[model samples]
Target: MRKILTPLLTILHRNTCFSVRLAAMALIATLPGATLAQGLFSPAITVNGDAITGYELEQRALLLRVLNAPGNTPELARKALIEDKLKLQAAKAAGIELTPEELKAGMDEFAGRANMSTDALLQALAQENISRQTLRDFVKVNLLWRNYVTARFGARARPTDAEVDRAMGRGGASGGIQVLLSEVIIPITPQTAAQVEALADRIAQVKGYDAFSAAATQYSASNSRADGGRLGWMPLTRLPAPLQSVILGLKKGEVTAPLALPNAVALFQMRGIRETGGSDPSYAKIDYASYLIPGGRSPEALATAQRIIDSTDTCDDLYGIAKDQPPQVLERNERAPRDIPRDVALELSKLDTDETSTALTRNNGQTLVLLMLCGRTAQSIAEASRDQIGNALIEQRLQSFSASQIEQLRADAQILER
Candidate 1:
């Protein structure tokens, strides 16, 4: 869920049957409200007025487990549950509300999103072995919290005409398209319709796939968002056979129609193509240059960077800058596992120096002149793009707002977590 801020200290009352069941369990078990002791761990510690039983944590953790959540750990799961409880408590203080039907609707969407039938979803929940009532309580809190946010925060809900106008003017990516991609992998299962399509979706994102550019414009996490579906140049073999065929057949700039596969649909656009060469970290040795002007004159930095780009035909002048001013060069470097994020290293394998990349971009009061395609290798991957950074910032703000609101509620909360 996206982050949210409260105008009137609103809480999203997302109560679920889980909270109710926990309460019921507390009553039936005759334990302190904070005693979280359950079936796991040594024994649960009872918190303020609630029971932070091991049983309870395990029950909540099971929800995450059932979904095969990535990189999950017991402690992380515990922290997440604590955060959820905090949210629930906050919602209650603010008098948030949710109906059973709304909860069911939300559950249905969640279940469907995971590609599970309602019955299957239930069965999975049952495997958690937490009472069905427990699930309901969880749903209850979530709904209530959302309601509270909309209500108490309703006054602050105004997105405003000026904001809207600003968004419009600044929203569209002037140069590129942002892409979002969802993939259902077989996890190596034999090619079934669902499995095949899932892989298809994933494959389609590999540069030259039919749907690569189009769907990516909507799904990709990139700075080139305003452009419909465009990506930087890509090597031929980076894609599978089906995708490679479409890309190889393309002109310098062409849109490929959606290609049907065993299970997926693909659409794409060829933004550009360029030369690549032999290197360990292929992009580490870059040929592209940047326009770095000092921060004394902000616009000049940008202008000078652009001027370097506009005046010079190539990165030939990069050395001149290093000669004239204090300069730093960032080389594409390779590292083994533990040295870099696995995903980043993988992306780096596909790029090279001399190629134009939206990577290596930043403007922190200093002039930025990025040289393209400095070098390449099967090395470290880059971090998020400018657009990715923006989206992330938005999400972070929402969470921070929610956290602050929760803190205010905590002051009045008769809350305890073990």
Candidate 2:
């Protein structure tokens, strides 16, 4: 089966500068073992008869390496190029093409991320053997894909004002307490119900958030599994009345006993609880750390992650494990929830200080990601700017819709990887 590179696409879309850097590097990186001219046009992979050349793969790998994108760069490059081919094919089929002016504008927009003009970016790329045409082509495909997705999915993707308000925790007229929750939902069929129940019982006894998160990654069927079952902040009243009481009873850092549903077993972890005077009760800041594990989501890799989780209690404890690893392997930062990747943010939302999740993967599923929440700072609704809240809500919805669209595309396409 062809492995989808959806994660790589997510990374690239979230960090446009990283994609641009890859574009420049893909154009510049020299080929080995063959003459540059020959290698430049040689097929590395083909999607629906469209070839992604070896040169393109090399350039993407070089660029990903340069930007410190995690996992196996060459493999990631191959997958990324394959997906790009698919996107390009889809866009062409949909009659979506970027005009010359539109393409130029896209390039300018990309260059602006680094505070450079198109010519300046091109000059920089040329210094490293990349061509201006390469950058233009990169921008052109992305522009076309963006236009296509928006045109096709925009109505469905659009968030109602009430939906945005609910996301911002302002849907209700009356004030209420808000809680930060991390949730895992394990799906079950009639055949798996008993087995799932047993597993849920075991998860209930897991020692920490890290263990819970690992379980979620391995066994959960929810979209939140990508971030280890994190649900971020929402009003207490927003929850189902029965679950609200159960959640309110959980102490900070406590995971609930599995609550059986019609088709799934659900659990929640209480990261925090706070009261607010106004409608919004969202967090203002979050501090966390991510430690990269080499293998993706394989059982062996998961076992290794379990070991890491068992060996540590706090983000600081990870320092001992990271003693000889590259500095980039461990990252600690304080960011707004909106500034953090959606997956990571959700995981962090399910954690108390020092709790970790092993739910996310990187580099086309060649690496495991361990994310630990270090702290969260809450702001009163009065202090939180409406614009910031609204913008954040819109971005989150857009990200969810974009991911869904890509997944649907991959599902419907007849992709052949070489």
TM-scores for candidates 1 onward, in order: 0.36, 0.44
TM-score, candidate number 1: 0.36
**By summed lDDT, which 10 consecutive residues of candidate 2 come out lowest?**
1-10
For model 2, residues 67-144, the per-residue Cα lDDT tens digits are 456665555566566667667887888988777788878888777766667787677666555566666766777777
What's the lDDT for all of these models? 0.44, 0.67
TM-score of 2: 0.44
lDDT of 2: 0.67
Residue 367's lDDT within candidate 1 is 29
lDDT of 1 at 10: 22
Clashing pairs in 2: 26-59
For candidate 1, lDDT tens digit of each residue in 1-418? 1111111012212222122112244353676544434344433543234445566566665554444343435655554555556666667777665666788887665556556665665676675564565566555656666666656655454454434323322323222212222221111113334754565555444654344445455543232433534434444433443455656566644555545422123444555554444421212121233444554234565455555545543345456545645556432333432343322332332334333322222333232324343332222223323354344444444445556676675565454443
